[model samples]
Target: MSGRCKGGKGLGKGGTKRHHKLLCDNIQGITKPATRRVARQREAHLGAHLRGDAWDVAGLTPSHLELIYEEMHGMLQVFLENVIHDTITYSEHAKGKTVTAMDVVYALKHQRHTLYSSGG
Candidate 1:
């Protein structure tokens, strides 16, 4: 506590837990101005300007297509599962046991979608 920053009780009797210890470190001492390289790295992650928007057929590879399809399929599966989960969780009886195919079927029927349309 002797060498610690002023105005905060040290992590001890009547003091905040260790989780808040960092808050006692004065921001002036903790923060530094960013170097040019760090700033450029951050910009590269986010604000890189688009190259010419002309038809980039050269970029369209089968692997890229497959990757896109895989990501889309994974997202669709997550959404469908969420819908089924919400439906089951909202029900009184179905909320208790392991969700079965019958439960999903009933939910989809009530929600007016086919089993395949439910995607599970």
Candidate 2:
């Protein structure tokens, strides 16, 4: 028989057990005030950059901006989730302890959102 024990729960090295960290509620971080602030900033930028009398005269209501913000926020959340999930998958497949920029690039490419360059 070999020196190593067989059919046993082997805690490698110093017998340290790995603990899985719990995921926090990230959605909670995007508070109503934060969303409002972002929406207002976007509205201001658009108002400043857009040309033509129609765009100049037309203004978005506060409620309209909020709705638009919610829609954009949801889409952004989904996109980030997909990208992060794919990045983690690639890292794990390569037995990597940390995610790299290349992992993100590859993940984006996998989702048909490829970037032209990964530099800097």
Candidate 3:
């Protein structure tokens, strides 16, 4: 018998190779108009909230509001950073590619900000 295998299951010498496009090319499908629309919507929503009754009740001047906004934003940023860091740590420890609700719950619990039990 010949040295060659009977079946043609072996890898062929010549075939058109599949070329995957770059990730950036795929991301380019989200056109500029769609991005602008989302930005405009967010701007409008934020403007409405800034002009809303909540701020009206506070009766703070623009300067005072700006100061408070900066302080509150800084505190929120720090809090979010801590929570996200903890969440990512939990996810990495569990060898999970995606963070689940349980990971978040556990992270919050670890930080003494427990939301709810894992069980129903």
Candidate 4:
């Protein structure tokens, strides 16, 4: 009965139509290249600050160091996601494709500049 329809946000409760629309909207668009580019730049800039000689190049302030570390962590997460995406799209059917920590290490060494330039 209508009395049981306690609708509003979230699951099978109520507002079911709106929830379905929201889900569709979320899935409708492809990820934008510009957005990915911005993410890569942010990561790389933060990375530059976190490197070993950064403090010597630019005096280390405690807060600045913490901020750099936080940015680096976020950038690493984004980079990892890209790596996973690339593997899924390009090598998925190649057989026995596994992404190990070493895979990330190798990818970073070889692909970092290219990925940054192209906005991966």
Best by TM-score: 2
Among all candidates shown, the one with the greatest lDDT: 2
Q: 116, model 2: CA deviation in Å?
A: 1.3
Note the residue pairs that clash in candidate 3. none
Models, CA RMSD each: 21.2, 6.8, 12.2, 15.9
Indicate the worst ten consecutive residues by lDDT in candidate 2.
Answer: 49-58
Best-to-worst order by TM-score is 2, 3, 4, 1
Give the range of the ten consecutive residues with the poorest summed lDDT in model 3: 23-32
Greater-TM-score candidate between 1 and 3: 3
Q: Write the per-residue lDDT of candidate 3 for residues 29-77, one digit (tens) a residue.
A: 5454554464456567678654445334147677886575555455545
- Per-residue lDDT tens digits for candidate 4, residues 9-109, read 46564443433332422312324344445556665788765545433414867787657655655665676667766655444444434655444444554
Identify the runs in model 1 with alpha carbons over 4 angstroms from their true place: 1-60, 90-95, 115-120
Q: How many residue pairs clash in each candidate?
A: 0, 0, 0, 1
Error of 4 at 1 (Å): 62
Residue-wise C-alpha lDDT for candidate 2, range 40-106, written one tens digit per residue:
6657767855434432313878787667667767876888899999999999999787999999999
Candidate lDDT values, in order? 0.53, 0.74, 0.65, 0.51
Model 1 Cα lDDT, one tens digit per residue, 6-109: 67554565544456343432322312122224334545655547333322334778787556545545554565667666567646475444666667676776
Q: lDDT for model 3, please.
A: 0.65
lDDT, model 3, position 89: 98
